[model samples]
Target chain A: MSIDPGMLLAIAMMSAVTYFTRLAGFLLASRLSLRGRARAAIDAIPPAVLFALIAPVVLTHGWPETLAAAAAGIAALRLPLLGVIAIGIAAVVILRALF
Target chain B: MTVQSEYQSSTADEIRQGLADIAPVLVAMVPIGLLFGAICTTKGWAASDVWLMSTLVFSGGAEFAAIGLWKWPIPYLALFVSTALVSARHILMGVSLAPKMHAFKGWRLWAAAWFMTDEAWALGERRARRQTITVAYWFFMAVPVHLVWVASTVTGSMVGPMLGDPAAIGLDFAFTALFIGLIAGFWKGATTAWVLVASGGASALVALTIGEPWNVLAGAAAGIVAAWFTATEPDEPESSSPEGHLL
Candidate 1:
């Protein structure tokens, strides 16, 4: 398929906005030390951010996908990283095909 | 502990250490990159487009959002707005890492910032809390993951057409499974577990109500606020052996 210049432009802008946050963090963090309530919030940010990233995908896709993903995730928790990935992928495929 | 353990010798050495620390995460990351690549390819994106997206945006979630928008042929302004909303977590990531990375200056900080991802931030934050400031360690962690991401995208783009739908083959499960693995690995105690549940539950509720990218923002805001309110005293002893250091 032909690459659209518009799509490329959009991608570049998205990239810039995305990179801005990281750059901002690095630059800003160097200037000040976070502590107290701020530190507490920062500490909590990862799980919150991660959940934000994951929850929507699972919800939009439906419960079956969520359950399957959860099961695969649990399986991944028990196995080696590669094995977990393989099993997770397998579970999704099987569940999709069966359901 | 040996002197080697006491101080990272050089920037290159520190980067190597960081990358070594992040190796286990690649298992989770590779599949995600592959999926993203597959999605882009399936959308009929060329190999160059795939690489450019991966390299430039360097954000799995944002890239996914961009591709989703691409399907609609959304205008560039709308795409940018959606991406910004989706990637709002980066603001939090920036805030969290700011204190720890205060020593870095100019271009070096910029480069490191570019490498920050959810996985990288989790690992980096944990290490920074432990006070591991060797530039090499951070570099090592970020560079390899970045490479794997780009490489997997290339692989996915090339093989994406030939492969059937990821949902058809169950590869989609890898994304959630990887996250679960990450969550489980970091489950230090009840507080952490509760925080996760609250975040997930809140995010889902908001998502069900608000829809699309708004759910992401609402969920994240809810989780952060809940965590802030339920903040625990840092009296508990730090774990000496953090997970993901086996290699």
Candidate 2:
């Protein structure tokens, strides 16, 4: 594929912004000691952020896909990490093919 | 002890420790990285580009998002905005590491920032809560994950397309199962569970209406706000705790 200047620029910007976000805490936490409500807010941030990241992917694909994925996940939960992953892949592919 | 001696000993120890600590997560990351490499290759990125992303960006979610958004012809500003929004958790990771990292300087801080992934952050928080800020400890926690991440991408770039349909061999399941496993591991209490459910519900609701990237942002915002409000207390004393606990 031909590389577009715009795409490269976007990728560069995305990289910069991502780096900035990652470094923000390191920069800010030391300078501004969080206390009281701010501390509470900080503590809650991670779970919220993580949930935000994971939830959409499951939902956007719809219930059938999500449910299939979840089922695969559930089955894999007790197995080794590799085992679980295998199950999930099989479920997605097989279900897709079946329907 | 001499400064050089101390530095050498610490670095050696850290590399050893970092590998050990990250072993379990690395196992999971390998497959995911491979999947990412494969997907990127399939999407037409060069092998070098795949490795470059893993080396530089080092963020699974953001990298994936970047690839997904590439087709949009979105402006760099929008891409950056989206990435920042997605990676907002890194800010939280940095905040939690503050007290432990008070003494780090210059390149050390920057290196830490660059390697501060979800797994690394989780491990670092656990170590920090115990008040262990040894450079070795952090290094031990970061390096292996980073190496595996880079290597896996390279592997995926080469092997992913060759594998053809990842679903054919069931490799595709690794992503969803791993995430589900993580959710199970992380859902400690009622509040956390609700936060996830609410976030999922909100994202789904928004997605059904708005679609595409907006769903990701809207869902994330809803979750963050919900968790912020429903949180039990501030100064809850770092979730990592000092007991080597896995919360």
Candidate 3:
């Protein structure tokens, strides 16, 4: 249950780096104006970063996961957020059971 | 500024609203947090270490990456670099949100930065673009997720043996589902199609070939590039231009 000083220090380092990243944007934005292409890039970050996370999970897992994600994506278009997630999870479970 | 004080009265409502707004994602987070704690425990990590990491690091991707890379001697420098890279996305999240969050100052601003996470950032971005939001809203949205996450991780670490396999019941899909829904929430018209395709395609390609965090960076890079071109359409007026659109 006890952690060594090294591990604690290492964890501290991780937290520091993460906090730095979080703060960097705000600091940078204060100093510099984000316009034109720079603004576009920053704007693109949300969906892009999110998709980047999602894409690999879908592709690597193959059809079952793909179908499930697709169901989620499609449901997300119309259903409530919780409903969409429910559909996606249900799809995975149902598909897993069926095949 | 005087404006900050005007917001002071509404803080309670904003926090409550923020908590309600993020409620959907919280459902999915429970299993993931528990799964994370269970994984750490299985890896021989102390329960305290699991809680400490979740509370301090507060990043699912980075913490998972760290545990995946865990071994004797800890590989301190390598672990730091990898986790940092995996979490590098936070920089973009902060940048994307900074404009909307400009009104927040002092401790409020610092706390917002500390509480920032991909889910909260996504939700905040949607709200900020649509309407003005308060610092309280931001904190409420972000902090509760952290609290629930930490609690679930602790629960998983302590009683991991009883929970059985998270994936067996398809609870693992909850993470992906939540992201899918959140991405949908960020949808911004037709142009988003190509941007998402490019992001997803590049990410999948890099993931299949190189693996780990690089795919995340590559996807973000590709998305930004693709969006730049798409936003620069000849017909669109400069004033109406899609500068900050997710596409």
Candidate 4:
């Protein structure tokens, strides 16, 4: 139990900040009404945010990763979610090895 | 049978389905969790402290950023601000999730928030699209993953930083692959195309130039802007704009 108090405090404060942000959206959404364009915007958020999250690998990583993402996107057209992920990982792994 | 009994039975089924739905993701998370813990230990974080960090913070990006910034003296204020900044997207995610959580009552809703991560929030949104989201279903989906994540950190810390360069074997690609699969769930044709391009392009651009989490914000903002613009068009389905084809 040699845990440093400063380290604990630091992690706690970070957690507090994280928890606050987690709640901030819930509070903000309750305060306002989502309709029309706002609704569309919210709807667009999932795909956008998700794609953006992976943009580093999909776009900047290399042609291999970009190709793998495209292959996975096509597989998404046919396969279920798990299949798409499997194919994507396989595609990236293969493409990286080949290149 | 009474209606109450039927509801109870249905709730059990819902929880089961929730667990089943997240089963693959939970499995996929093992390596990533170990990677996070291992990296932190390499940075000289105590195993107990690493475990606690995962248990309390329960976020991947923010934790990684904090670990990157971890040094002997500890940059307390800097770490706090960076974590807040990295996790700011959660606010938007929460806004998107609020309306969909109709099945959760007051306290249940707040409790559910504690388990809310990007994946959980996204899964909740996806679930809401098809049916109502109950606290039972939500917790079943979110909590197990959270537990696995916490457990992985502890294991990783104890084992120490063993996995070197997850990308060489393509473990790093797992998360990106998973996100692509999840995003596919939200497809909406032309509108989705624009949002994907705008967000992906802006995020990639920013990630290349600036770095880390700011890319998420830029991409999200661009995507939202694209969505707003797309929604403003006349209700009639327009032909794929030449501009879109240009890309």
Candidate 5:
């Protein structure tokens, strides 16, 4: 597995762009000085982002995935993180098998 | 209790909790990291490249996108754009996360930003919701995830395990499950319910239509808009509303 200059360039570009993305939001937010509805919008980010992330997996994958996601999601309300993971994996596996 | 002593004790507690908090995610990452490295190895990419990308680029989704886009001639612009697009969510994540890390001073805040993966950011936000996010907590939560990701990727390049379908074992659902739990922590009754339904539905619709990265932005924007319209304003510091106390 020898190194290639071309590959190195690609890696550098990816790294530079990614680091910038990570920092840009913080820098941008620092200057904004938001309040009220804007602050509420920001506070809502965690859940909003989370749901956006898993939506395709849960909603579009299939019935098994959707149902399994619900099982795991409901488990989340009552279980610890590890327990929720167990339930989700188990539910998906079983549902996939049944369907 | 003196302020200094309280800070010291809480720092220690946060450190331990931070490690504990990230433990399950680290476990979930193992198969993913291994699979990533194995794919690179099978694709005939150099070990150094695998390790470097994992260490430097340090984003699983972007790195995976790069692998998909890899070729002999190397589509440089396509590669760069895809990497940027796949990782663009970090911008939104950082926007939300920056305001909460009040205790992170100066360079520490910037430094911490390096490890703000989806899992790390979600866990950090969870921590912030319950109490102040201490430096020790953030570092301990984020740093180990980075190290483990790098280590696992390198190992996978070497071993190149023939991991069968991850979906078959339900390994793919691990992140979804973990996120489900994390998202549940943000529950605030109907307001949050509306925010999630809008975000998830829009995100899913976009993923089915326009696809990747755009879906994230579209959905998040929708959720934020829902938040603005539906949420009771947490405008005052000592207000009785649940949001007022937290936000």
Candidate 6:
């Protein structure tokens, strides 16, 4: 099948945008100085951003996802990383089977 | 200068050790990458398109958002904007990692940034917290994940439909599981708990209402706000930018 040149252009643009953001850190850090609260905010970012991403999925996806996310979140607190993932995936599979 | 030379002169064993460190994350990424490929085919995207996006964009969240918004007429402006917004997190990721990578120079530094993913950044941060991370370690850790990701995309786009509905087998949850595992590593203290609740709540609210990538942005903003309001004893922050290290 023939490829759409427009779509190809879109993909290229998307890639460029993504790369710019990835490279932005080093570029910005040189020009700007972050100290005190600003630095604290950056430190706080990863977990907060991750939570934001996961929350919508769990809240909107119904009980199976919620229950599984709960199991995973709880397991994450106590178990090893891989074990957390295992229990989460297992919970989802089993929940789907039962419900 | 010495550290730069040391990392630059890293032995093969160090590189291989880097690969070993990221092995588990790579295994988890398999299902998600394949799902992305399958989703691309389902959306009527060309195989070339899938290959280009996966190899170039290399972000599951952005690609997924772009595909979700794709239409027949093709909303080029909207697609570009939303994908950028979804990937905005990488900007912060870049900042968090820049200190450790200050020792790198030229193409080596650029390559490290190019391969930076949420998983890679988190793993790199964990390593940097414990010990210095070298270019060799970063390369080995990142390159294998990138290769596996691209290959998985190609395989899924071609063979994904044959596997039937991925959702049926709970394979769709892999991305969620992946994020959860990564977040688990970042959970630091009560501050983390407050930030997570604030961010997650904001994200869920935005998702239910606006229903797009804005949720992440809003959630992040809310979390930052919460961080500002929450008080804790004065302590040295984990890591800081190389204000002095930058040249």
Best by DockQ: 5
lDDT of each: 0.69, 0.65, 0.81, 0.80, 0.84, 0.77
Q: State the displacement of the C-alpha of residue B39, model 2, in Å, after optimal TM-score superposition.
A: 3.5
lDDT tens string, model 1, B1-247?
A: 1112344367776666676667767866776777788888767788888988888888887888878777655578778888888777777787777666644566777887888888888777767645555556767787777889999987888887676665655656666766665555555455566667677777777777876677666766776676667667643432442211211
Off by over 4 Å in 1: A1-8, A34-36, A57-99, B1-16, B71-74, B234-247
Which 10 residues in a row give candidate 3 chain A its minimum summed lDDT? Answer: A30-39
Tens-digit lDDT string for candidate 3 (B125-207):
87765556577788878898889989999888888878899889899999888889888876766557777989999999999
What's model 1's lDDT at A28? 55
**TM-score of model 2 vs. true structure:** 0.72
For A10-94, candidate 6 gives per-residue lDDT tens digits of: 8888899998998998676634545556656666777777778888877787888889998988887787667777888889999
lDDT of 6 at B6: 25
Model 1 clashing-pair count: 14
TM-score of candidate 1 versus the correct structure, residues matched by position: 0.80
lDDT, candidate 4, B1-247, per-residue tens: 0112113447788899889878768767877888888888778777788888998999988998999999979898789889987988888888878766655667787788888888888788787666667778899999998899999877877775556776777777777777887888888779889999999999999998999788999998899899988975434332321111111
lDDT for model 1, on a 0 to 1 scale? 0.69
Query: Taking the tens digit of each residue's C-alpha lDDT, what string does model 6 give over B1-247?
Result: 2223224335687687687778878877888888889888888876777888888888888888888988888888998898889989888777766766755788887888888887888787766655566788898898887898889988888887886776777777766776787787776677777888899899999999998688988888888777766636434543422232333
lDDT of 4 by residue, A1-55 (tens): 4779888899899989988888878766743445567677887888888888889
Q: Cα deviation in Å at residue A72, candidate 2?
A: 8.4
lDDT tens readout by residue for model 2, B1-247 = 0112113345576667666666667766776788888888767777777776777777888888777766554556656766876677677667766655754787788877877887777666544544555677787778777889989988888888775665465454455555555445444466666667776787677667865445555655566566666666554644443322221
lDDT of 4 at B51: 82
Which pairs in model 2 have colliding backbones?
A40-B234, A85-B174, A88-B173, A89-B173, B18-B140, B18-B141
Comparison by TM-score, 1 against 2, better one: 1
**Highest-scoring model, lDDT:** 5
Q: What is the lDDT of residue B121 in candidate 2?
A: 76
What's the TM for model 4? 0.91
Interface RMSD of 4: 4.4
Q: Evaluate residue B112 in candidate 6 and report its C-alpha lDDT on the 0 to 100 scale.
A: 86
Ranking by DockQ: 5, 3, 6, 4, 1, 2
**Candidate 2 Cα deviation (angstroms), residue B122:** 2.9
True-structure RMSD for candidate 4: 6.3
